[model samples]
Target chain A: MAGGTEIVAHRSGIEKAVAGLILVACAFYCFHALGLNFGSLSNPRSGFMPSVIGVSATVLAAVNLVLTLRKHRMAEADEVALDRYTALNLLMALAGTIAFLVLLDLAGYVVASALYLLFLTKLTRSPGWLVPMAVSIGATGFFYFCFVMLLGVTLP
Target chain B: MENFALLMQGFQASLALHNILAALAGVTLGTLAGVLPGIGISGTIALLLPISFGMEPLTALIMFSGIYYGAMYGGSITSILVNVPGEGASVVTMIEGYQMARRGRAGAALAIAAIGSFVAGTLGVVGITFIAPPLAQVAIAFGPPEYFAIAALGLLVLTNLSGGSALRAVLMMLIGLMLGTVGMDYMTGLVRFGFGVDGLGDGLDFIVIVMGVFGLGEVLARICERQNDVRVTKIKFKDLYPNREETRRSILPIFRGGLIGAIMGLIPGPSGTISTFASYALEKKLSTRREEWGKGAIEGVAGPEAANNAASSFTMIPLLSLGLPFSASAALLLSGFMIHGIQPGPMLVSTEPVLFWGLIASMYIGNLICLILNLPLVGLFASVLRAPMRYLMPVVALVTFTGAYVLNYSLFDLGVLTFFGFLGFFLQMSGYSLAPLALGAFLGPQLEQGLIQTMVLTDGNIWTLMTRPLAGTALWLGVAMIGWMIFRFIRQLLRRSSSQPVAEDV
Candidate 1:
């Protein structure tokens, strides 16, 4: 049972592999986008340093993949455990957060955030209309006190 | 003698009504943030940094510093009650602390943590007072080359710090270092990875990268995970303060932690974090009653709590003395010094004696204030977990993004926050420690500036990194540490090999 857990983890290695690849690829994008030449002092190209990082990220991914595969092999003996609901909650939270950030400028911080909170709380297992309303109104009011009144921070 | 007088002046100023109020406000906000899940004090501080623009530098810094230390004190509140750690620094505390709470000993754990924090924090501040000035004296003699060596030594923590895979840690560190090099070449005034965006001209603001990777990224991931609903148990008032028997059990740990924290703080790397972890391991390793450790043994809570506070104080040693930041918060403090146009290195003792010694003296006062406040408010802070995440997260978001906009009134940094937040989330998912990545980004530009200047001065002698005696000695020490790590790893491997066959046979 314990061993099977690691096998479960190995399944998630694809994510790491993908992420590392993206990081590395982004490095190439960053590399091509820069101008590195200067006068006679002759500095290293901007992309040169970044490419090194990109390659390093790629290497890290390869290693991660290897570890993941190895863990998968051991999964039969030692299975990893994951909490599904916890993971699901995290996903909803992320989506809600992204929507909040994207639309905050248009809707304004207080209004946009209220919608984000209202939506997330309602979607979660604790979905009470009161919970979302209280959370949204409370969040806006607190921000108003600290950022608006006390700190005099002008909201976007 | 002059330093002593200046410390006195600083003490007086730190205690002034406005500064004290700021410290109180910082602690209140810090505790609220610490008690809440998914929100961190760093993001909060980043949010408020711009508000200080209109205020006097002293008042502003005093408030931020309070926010900083207050968060540390408050972070334990969350970890002890709920199984979730509100901040990374308090992760270890949550382990034993929640276990203690489960065993119906929440009061005991809280008492030990608060008391130990007070004791170690006081001693740690004393260590800062004595250790910092002399270190500053030595730093005064340092050139850019020496600075580079020190910075390198700090960055190398990525390897030893990687709990699982050293190679991966090194890989992450190198990647982070390269990321640091992105943006404008300060010396040449030329853009490196700016991509012709006018915004890229200044290079990526470390704040943006840091907030994104740690703050926004973490939020995104947290939002997705189905979390346990917040539950904070009540604490009886009588049980809030540790009695003599409990205090006696905790004494040795607090003392040990104080000493360890002081020494670690003086080192160039992320000493505070390492010290806290090491203190916990040491407590567990040395305890005759080992089983009690995971069960929320008072010593377990006491030792690491003390270590954490002590480390916080000692961090100032490097920041105030060498102007070399060894942690993320310390780097930000260094930035604060630069913002105030007070270079925090050797010259601090000479040029800004009042401000410098005042801060040092204020550390002592601050510790006292923490003690006075923490014991009475344990339950209050613990109860903060009752608030819903839906309510908590938005306030945090508004503060952070609003804080970003106020910097240059640019929405771009907010984008940086989202991007880095996702990145931080991914890194967290993959078991990559964002500590090194973040500190690297923060220190990268400074390290670059130092290295470029040092190289030019030496006429392209890469060997200069080695030849300089003081720096050379530090380099050798690093080599020795590596050698020792290899030895330990081999020994561990052999032990595991021998045990493997036995385990298989069993």
Candidate 2:
């Protein structure tokens, strides 16, 4: 019988390989922690439903691995060269998020937000100091007006 | 007669200057974020949600709706100008829209979209004004069992929309149901899925998950795939509006699109995306000039764009009448009602008729504002597409962080945002369509609740769903949907299998 069809840069083998391994490891851990057997409708248990989830997840993971082996091969994605700069950009984006959080805790929302905006503006190779500075301030002021003044949501 | 007078008063109230300005602000901000890659409407709404907290409930809701519709419009911009369709519905538009752009008909394509959105949105508002109260009367009589039935029907509707992959959709829906189980149990209020984290006590914020999956994940995937320069040329001025002939050809599609949108909007669930996709598929299939489709056929852009906006307006019907929020935008608006300490249901009709009818009436006002602002600002919007990737990424990241943080003023929110963002990114990178995943997230909880309720009401006899007429019809409909999907799947497999030998033989 025919299985899954071919797709361009389709992720079958690699995804299954990775997700399968994680599923196996995670499912076992989850099973050990949470028991199966959610009691009858009269009495539901905490670990009851989770046991099914954990066990089923493990089985699904194993099934996925088999499907990957049968339906796909690594060579399908070989034509494409994985670019490096893309990875770097993603990392920068993630790191920037980390920094923004740290800054939010240290400074108030306005100051930290302004600084982060300026930094982001610079990444675009945005010309001129005025635009970024003006934007940063405007963003900060806007947030202050919206969060602090209106919603009664206290933003530090 | 007094009711008519009250309705008129609410309608006039929506036309006020402040409400107009608020709607303008929302759509403008929404378009900016929605047009941008990785900045989805949900994310923009979530980011702006904290700000909405401080505004008057009406102002907050108008702005929120603007953002929702604006994102729909904005999403089409990138899809047409570039090949990236920020949302799934835009994928259909992208087929014909970007093709039109590449051929340098971007202006006409965009013009059709704007006009179509206006026509549909206006009609949808009209529909809501007349239909909502009657629907509310029915909804008022609904018990928990009825709600369970509605949710079950929504799942059935979703199954038909799995883009032909029913199995994957079912699996995804189940996963969403499981994830929805993670917070404190609704009945028991018992802690679940806390993972020892205090933040998990309340469960993952729905908005947070949407942003991570739709906003941050999209950016991450783009970064991974587009390490090299990935800019597309911006659409120029002359190409902005469709010619007379194009407009003539598009009229019927626009009307049909509006009707579809209005109807879809009143439904419970993520009908915005579903409606748009359905319209585009229908439009493409019906268009006399089918070959023009995916070649940036103006109808492709017009139909879906109109549908999304119409749905946005009509969604207010159920929210105003029954206080039902099937989609995120409606939920956001529903939250507005709660903030004012006014529950939005049957009582909202009599109790807060002003707020209820005012918002509905304001939709007409909002439609006018959208036309005035959006069309004139197309050129300016084009410039946004030219923004370099580096700057866009960090801004999106920071916005994600700040938006999450401001919501709870907790550092833990940031952690939740980033972690989910990564998970979202991974899901995208792995080729699992996020649309189904997100749709499942929105629908799963409600479906589970419905299933449980239906089961309970039936007294442990799972077959009672078929015994009750309305609920049974819905159950049968759900089964039919699954069966149809299975049939489609088999057909697809056969088509693929049949075609394979030809390729090898060649």
Candidate 3:
């Protein structure tokens, strides 16, 4: 029973955090939209739609936040929120992706992609070094042939 | 008769060697994507959108349509053999299908699903051939006000039906609309929210967001999941044919499911998934072999499978006629058309007759190809499930990154892709539906454009804009939907409160 309570709390906590984030984002968007031109109703300018969207979103977010605080049932999370290990997996994958981007700029597609693939394969717990290495190299080669050789895309 | 003649011309056009090859490749790739649980039709199409850049618009669209139809067939394979639904629409199929598989009728389940998909899909195409032209003809009469009202009604109906809090869907949609505003203001030639970034000048590319959210976002989500060993049921090629009893039973359900799907597909919000559930319930209720339900009933598999495919075909009606996409996959298809400098709507029938009719005609061929491929190649496709996610995810990530780069050859776009990929992952984790966001971003400009045009036409008298007949009806419908949602919410709250006291007393 305590475990069930803990799970519900954790779920609600995530929902509240998401609602808060949305509220902040919408507020910022509304502020930015306000800085743009506000033309007349008949002949609106560039900022008209943004302003309307931003303000409406801000209001909606605020309502959502209130609903969350009141413990009213809102949108139930479709998938389970990340646990500690899964969160770690996500962070590692994200870091690997960012690193791949940096590497691509410094090196080339083949080198960057190969290294990224190797890291990801290992991150997903590929048994040993041999399989990850083979997959990374083979996949990079296939991509090179498909994109550059066949499609004539100049990959950075 | 004229429409038939045009359809004949379309058949001639689609019969080209290149178009046939495109159809073949699309269905094959789509089936493979469907068999793999990690990716879906949206991700596959997003990943391949860049590749389609070099092809002619007709060929590209034909391939996309083929992929759409093929995924339907492929999704059933995983559901039957592994008890894992490959897509949302196949969930019901897994109930009876896996049971059948366990009873050594896996081949029959798969065969029935394929045949049902083919029959329903062809029916849907025939419906499109007859119904869509007339729908487009009517849509051609819509003014800016009516367009605005239609867009508004679509978003409202979708939010209500999208299976979550209406508030959450609306919020996501607003965010998407805000994102759509990032680029240049088309009418004024003034940039609204560029943030002084050079990439912001042209606004965010729809395909980039799609690839990031559907492709990379999916990968990120999958990585966090605990990998389970998938056990595939082996099938003898000889057992692929359904017995006479099974075949006879499936026939009516297939036609009935197809009819349900064809009608529901014309509505908004995940019609394919909805229609399948509806079909499943109806079949169970109407079945003579009621005791077999939830066991190894062939009708259970046949009905929902047909409904989903038929629904998929029907979903194209709104997109092809009104230039509106009611679902995520349809939105991707719309992007495919847009990328080719084509807009699908009333004007398309007149302006791009060959392309319009050709796409419709190609569905016939695509459905045939899917049926043929699914039967003989079931073993080959099912083997894809055995590939470990550890190796597969990396390839997906690399392809995503590579595809993002090829779009504009800009590092900025890659950065945007990464940003949205993470954003999508987090948003999905929070239980936000990404479909509304995708549709919002896609429709934001059109919605804004319509609003502005209506305002201009009505000379700032907004009420006058609503006074227009078609526009008035659509707006009223949206209002009624919102009212209904509020009433339902209040009723639920009251019921919960009442139930709580009874529970405490007990």
Candidate 4:
């Protein structure tokens, strides 16, 4: 129970930090908008709407931050449990997407997409190498036929 | 007489051989897509958008129009056979429809839902045919202030109606609005928020976000959750029809649901889902057999299914007439219009009468096709649940990623997809809905343009917003909606507090 409380506290800290980061981002955007000249409302310049939204967003984020902090004080913060395997799977998904992004322009769509699919399939379940390879190849071939051959979409 | 003639001409165009085949293929594919558990209406449309890229605009539209109503029919299939709703609008259908299925009436539930959807869809198209042109004519008189009021009101209502806390919804909406302000300012020709990236000079593609957030994010979420083995009861053809009394009980509810759905569709803000819920509530209130509501009531299946299909059909009005999309699905249709190099607005009818009328005409044919398609294939579609998520999600992810990459062929868009997917997952995990955010992103620029134009016309005087009749009414309606939400929030808070004492005492 004590360990659970500790984990909750740790999660709360992370949550508050994320809220603070949002506030900071809002401030940064507002600062950028302020740098651009704010024309009159009648003849608004490029920055007018952005600056207004930026300010409004900053206020909302501030309110959200306050609410989060208050909820934390009341000890009612919800803890989102992240199991190790699930976390690993999420990271693997992210890695696969990043790899696809890099390989998309380099290795081309078929190879990159196949690699990403294979990686994701393997990450989700411990499939044999053959199954992952077969699935990836099949998926890539289908995408190519539908998108490239049929739809006339250009791919790298 | 003139409108009838116009519709006849549209049928003449829509009934062409190629168009018929497109409609058939579209509804078939759409029903299959909708029958899949994780693939939603918006996600299905987004994934298939690339396939339509090569087709002529009319053919593409005939296909899309088929998919639109076909999804409504397909959604109720899974809801009845399994407890899982294939789409958001069918969530309420699962409540009572599943119970009906459990009582050995799955076939009856499915049949009633299909019939209701067909009735609602047909009536809704009829409503749209008459109502849209007049609405467009009226919209022609609207100035920038009126347009701004309408668009801003839509964003505000979306934020309010989105399921979550008001603060979080507003925050997400503001974030979406900020995201919209990225890229270059059109009026000033000034680059903003590009952060030195060449691709950011043009605003983010809506399709990329749709693919990422709705498609890949959902896939990731599904992957993280443990899959449960769902049991599907085999439905036979002979058992499809309800008894005579059951049919009698359903007819009134179906008509009521269609009426409710058609009206809600015109109002915006998750209209399809809202209409279903509203119809279900209305049915419960008015049903003589209210005692059987939670226990596999036939009215439960009929009303919401009818309402959602009707709502889906009429939801086109705002997009077609006013050039504003109320939901992500409507936004997809708007994107479809833009892809065809035709803008949807008050001038759409005048500018592209054939395209506009042809789409409306095709919807009627699509409805007929969906009814023909879904009623017999409910059993086959329900068996799709046997496919495990492990095998399914990987394919979904691949399609989503490919769709994103193919849109602009930009690695930067892939980056956007990844970022938004991550963001969408986090927001969804935190119990924040993405509909408001999506609405904000879609409507934000239009709202900005309308506001700026109005400002220029009014010389920056904000009070002139209230001086215009239509703009004033819209702004007041928006304010009233916000006020009502605040009141409801406070009342709920008070009730919670009052109940807390009783709980502590217990």
Top-DockQ structure, candidate number: 4
Q: TM-score of each model's B chain?
A: 0.90, 0.85, 0.96, 0.95
TM-score of 3: 0.95
Candidate 3 falls in which docking quality class?
A: acceptable
lDDT of 3 by residue, B388-469 (tens): 9778877888888888899889988989999989888877766788888888888888999998898888878888865778
Off by over 4 Å in 2: A1-14, A21-37, A42-65, A74-82, A99-103, A106-153, B1-6, B95-105, B222-242, B262-297, B311-347, B439-458, B480-506
Instruction: Give a tens-digit lDDT track for model 1, residues A1-54.
Output: 011112233324534454556556545644453344422222433344445455
Candidate 2: tens digits of C-alpha lDDT, residues A24-64: 65465466537533555434444444554456556655554
The better candidate by DockQ, 2 or 3, is 3
State which candidate, 2 or 4, has the greater TM-score: 4
**Candidates sorted by lDDT, best first:** 3, 4, 1, 2
lDDT of 4 by residue, B220-298 (tens): 8777555566688899988998899889989998999999999898876788899989999998998777679899989
TM-score for the second chain in candidate 4?
A: 0.95
Per-residue CA lDDT of model 2 for B1-506, tens digit only, reads 66567779876776678877888988888888878765666656655665565567777767776777777778777887778886665777777778887887877877788788888888888888788878877777776556666665664565455443344444445455456566776646667667688887887666666667766676656544432455665656666667898898789888888878887876655677778888888888888887776666777778887888788778777677766665655655554456556677776776678877777766777677767777878778767777666556655655666566666667886787787787777655554444445545555555545555555666657676677776677667777776886687567557755664221100
Stretches off by above 4 angstroms in model 1 are: A1-11, A26-35, A38-102, A123-131, B38-53, B87-96, B99-104, B268-270, B280-296, B336-343, B479-506
Better of 2 and 3 by lDDT: 3
Candidate 4 CAPRI-style tier: acceptable
Relative to the true structure, candidate 1 reaches a TM of 0.86
